[model samples]
Target: MSAIFYIDQLPNRTIDHDGQAYLFFSGTAYLGIPQHPDFHQLMAESMRRYGTVFGSSRNGNVRISVYEEAESMLATRIGAESALTLSSGMMAGQVVINWLQSQHYTFVYAPKAHPALWHAPTVTLPQLAFADWTAQLPGQLSALSPGPVAILVNSLDAVCSDYYDFDWINQLPDNRPITLIVDDSHGLGVLNNGRGIWPTILQKSVDKPASVRIVGTGSLAKGMGLPGGVVFGDANAIQSIRQTAFFGACSPMPPACLDAFLRADALYAEGQERLQRNIKLAEHLLLPTGLFHQASGYPVFFTEHDALYANLLQKNILIYSFAYPTAADRANTRIVISAFHEVADIEWLAESIFG
Candidate 1:
């Protein structure tokens, strides 16, 4: 394995890694604000106003008005009724799973969904028989013992079907009640005109008999270029999860971090114009390689090749080579375009990839 090191050096969009500098075609800094000047200023101001850490959870002595305000903004953005802030998106998932376990509900999930969905103590449907999201969820729901069941879905996987199709998801047998939980960590800031998949699911899940619980988890670190996670859902469901023992036991995001996020939100709004530009650029750059095979919500294009990835890294470009759990398939790599990258950078990446 190659020795991993934190990126302490900033090279041009193309920089030297082993011996050559090449255009970077990988990694998930989608918005590219981590090193932006304005973001740096916001962080500096935040540090002065709100120290390094809050030292308590939302219910503790370190509570800040900004935390609540950020949550409200995020809820409004995602079209949820209320929102809760957490240390990370993984933590948000854990909170949701813990709550579901307390209710003693068996869970059925799309096999490609993030691991956090089934990592808790809940019973999961047989992994081999029901692995695909589009594989008729209603059939699986009918097979479960007569009782409450929760279905978790993720929209990020390349082979998975769209979870936003309301007509199909709501048709589960009327006799059995099921709650739908969606983890949109990858979908939140990059889909549905940037309003996210949460609001669409929330609106569609309203008439279900099982007392619909619509919850979404997102990380501000990805597209938003900030650190933190958000959980939003119906009012009562969020309240129930808050009472869990782990909910209030940890520290909250420092006011400074929240402040930086607030600024990042504004920058994100302005950065949309660049996002569109990069998407067009990527389509042109990657279409010829026959490797940019799929699109989920963002600009992370998937290609099947390990040597392409190692070559890119040798040129100092970082790309994500996340393999699917079912390893029998070909290894896939992801090509991400950051908002911080310029048009020249995109052209250079295209040349490098196709050279």
Candidate 2:
């Protein structure tokens, strides 16, 4: 592999090398708002108002009202009692896991939990259990020795499950005090009646027994086209986690970025109509590809390919490839369909993948 450290030298999404610009189908910027005029203007205005950087932690002089408002909006949108913003999704996961460890809790995880969840030093359950959508979740829950066990679940593909049915997941016997820590990075802004994943989970948490603690983490960089991550739950859980050493040490998000995210949230709400259209297009396109399988929430299509990494690159399509450190090498590639893609882009992608 070649050692490339900078973005400018790396392959640009649009290339003049081919004597014409071609659409790039790589990276997770599905919403295509990174360069949208409204988002751009909001970011530019924020920069002018707040300068480029905040240069302090949320606990210090850098915190802004916009940050608090955004958190509240996010919490309301996601159905959490409160929310905490972090510099990145990895930070969100790390801080949450740190809190979990401080509580002396063990984690039972699905095989597909993101690396951040697995990397946390507090994690105890070694081998992740695997199950498909049809598999009985209650059976799996019952099998676990009922102690201070917390199950780490990803929205989909983690347990080879569908949008986790709240009714089914909450069916954990009242006798068992298992916490459900979910990473809805993919599901947020794209699932749960198009209202986003966090709020749905929060509502479910509210309706469930008080003993069932629900924690959710997500990235704004994906569907929202903004950079940062959020961790949300009960105010006490959030407050407890925020007081940790790790949370205190990290720098807060830049004010301008936060402003941009606030705008992005509004735009995301408006863009839902278009998002639905794109989802339908993606499903139609993928259903014909015998190699592809449909997944609910987030316009993601899964397909198995041994040469996915090299092949997509050869076609100038950037995609996520799960390698050993990031993930166990699976014979599958996840293709994310953004609402920004044109109908032609979808057709072209289908041709490239199936032709």
What are the lDDT figures for the candidates, one per model?
Answer: 0.68, 0.67
TM-score of each: 0.86, 0.81
Q: Write the per-residue lDDT of candidate 1 for residues 214-252, one digit (tens) a residue.
A: 577766666666677777877877887777787878566
Q: Candidate 2 lDDT, tens digit per residue, 1-355?
A: 3112234322223423334344554455555567467888889998998888777767775457888888888888777789998888878887888877777776777655775676454444335334452255566667767566677877555222245555545556576666787887766666764445666665555557656778888777766666788898789889998888888888766778877777676677655656677768877876676765666545666656546646666675554445433243443455666666778777777777775
Candidate 2 local Cα displacement, residue 172, angstroms: 2.2
Worst 10-residue lDDT window, candidate 2: 2-11
lDDT of 2 at 25: 49
How far does residue 279 in candidate 2 sit from its true spot (Å)? 2.3
Task: Judging by lDDT against the true structure, name the best candidate.
Answer: 1
- Candidate 2: residue 114 Cα off by (Å): 1.4
TM-score of structure candidate 2: 0.81
Which candidate's TM-score is highest? Answer: 1
